[model samples]
Target: MEYKVIAFDVMGSDNGLIPAVDAAIKLLGEQKDLKIIFVGDGAALKKELSSRKHNPDQVEIYNTTEVIEMTDGIMDIRRKKDSSMVRALELVKDEKAHGVTTGGATAPFIAGCHFILKKIDGIERPGFMPVIPTVVKGKITLLLDVGANLECDPEDLVNFAVMATAYSKAVNGVEDPKVALLNIGEEKSKGMELHQKAYKLLEDHEEINFFGNIESRYLASGIVDIVVTDGYTGNIALKAAEGMGKSLLTEIKTALTKNIFRKLAALRLRKAFKEVAAKFDYKNHAGAILLGTKSIAFKSHGSSDKVAFYATLKMTYNAIKNDVVNKLKKALAE
Candidate 1:
């Protein structure tokens, strides 16, 4: 289960661009069947490659004259015809690579995915499926439509649940994954009309193990493995969780360093506390699969460092090896 080749957008990072590329190439080179292709200014990448003493022969560069600036809006997709994001996706559309990974602008990546890789059969919209860390046995949950398709119909949400459930079972090793819709309350009457409709749809579907409805308060409880929602709400919830985690860490650090006595106590509990903190580190799980795409495409955080970038590449490799695209397609066709 080797990925033939993995393509990356090499012009997105503000810093660590060379190190990220070097790490990806080094990691993939270790795999016998894996080859790496970078899409960006060929001369610049080659210069960086030479500095790292990395073999340019093991890597292929798809030269693109235009580079999409990180500050550009999603409309930049149309503005930058020769952008690396566009070129990377073009490789996927042309079957030059098994998948593409990018730590680039989210809007441009979404636009490129829609314009180039396109949607899968029976899927009118593509969604972002990101793995959320759970408290249950250190397992991960799949949250679908996380800032990809902002407005979604009932059928779209239903499809998201199905695709997310399949992805959780396949990648996270969950059997008969419990699916829940994000709602304001557990009661059937809670939430908006669309949520109620989605609830009924899940309840009526026998294929997935619908776990009624889950409130935001119970998000990290790990009661369910998949939480389905439209991109707007899901994106806010994901960002909120991330912010909360960072804030909590800041508060803890401040409290622990207040005085000599507290600092000593912090040192005593530092190892255990760090272990707990690592559970919520989003960088550990950096890639989000652009579900419903014809080919695998991963969207990573734009500000990701070398570690996060490497994690994304690893995720891309696993998704290709696991045949995630075909699995999602077959599940959707059913």
Candidate 2:
């Protein structure tokens, strides 16, 4: 087994570095073939590790005193050379690690990725690909450009489709992942000029299994394995889906706990409810991978706790182990 190393940006998280550190320590124990590098303040990291029981040989620390604040703009990526996020990314760039994961500010981390990691050859722009759960049990959909590029052309959509298809095959174990364009209606000509052009491009593309256009309503239905759209539209759809999932779950809880009889029923259905909750929980999903980059990079939620961090770390390790970047490159080259 080839050993894998994943770097974690241990600062800028809403809950601070402790969660990241704890998650890394736990992961190291489970994956004997994996090692971890924590990029952050040396003193704090050492202090935290002192209390945790982990294999010292599998852990390393690259100390950086600076941290990119949530308010920091994209330009700060270049300026903050010693920041935890940049250093963790640098680990991948320097070939010290196979992948990088962070619960840090999004914009600067993305900009840093564009500048430092660069894009895979032939990819015009990188897309934020998150593994979103579908209504179908144990099925997931890959939604791209959640906020990476505000606007994209037909070619970009095709590239996103190609990349997503490759990811679905390599990571999700799909034989031939079905791809769709998110539009106003299922009709090919229903959307704007961009969607129309994208539909034609995707339909003509031989690399992916194009499934035509999909409306936002059916995005979570697991009808398609991947959904491609411009960042502006995709971001709105993603947020709306998240909001609706949370609201529906909240309403269900309210309805089930309002009366004594309903409370008993809720108790009886506790396992089923947990299964549903786990499917929709952001913490379980963890990170949005920056697809089309030269190497694997993930942007975890800033508010993620230890569980979320662990999920992201495990994903990063698996992507590296599976050689996701090379598979994607091969797919694009074909």
Top candidate (TM-score): 2
Off by over 4 Å in 1: 1-3, 29-32, 53-58
lDDT of 1 by residue, 64-167 (tens): 98877888888888888898888888888898899999888888888888888888888987889887887776767788888898989888888988888777
Give stretches of model 2 more than 4 Å off.
Answer: none
lDDT for predicted candidate 2 compared with the true structure: 0.91
State the weakest 10-residue window (summed lDDT) of model 1: 49-58
Give per-residue lDDT, candidate 1, residue 217: 67
What tens digits encode model 2's per-residue C-alpha lDDT throughout 152-210?
A: 99999999999999898898899999999999999989888999999999999888899
TM-score of 1: 0.93
The TM-score that candidate 2 achieves is: 0.97
Residue 81, model 2: Cα distance from true site in angstroms = 0.9
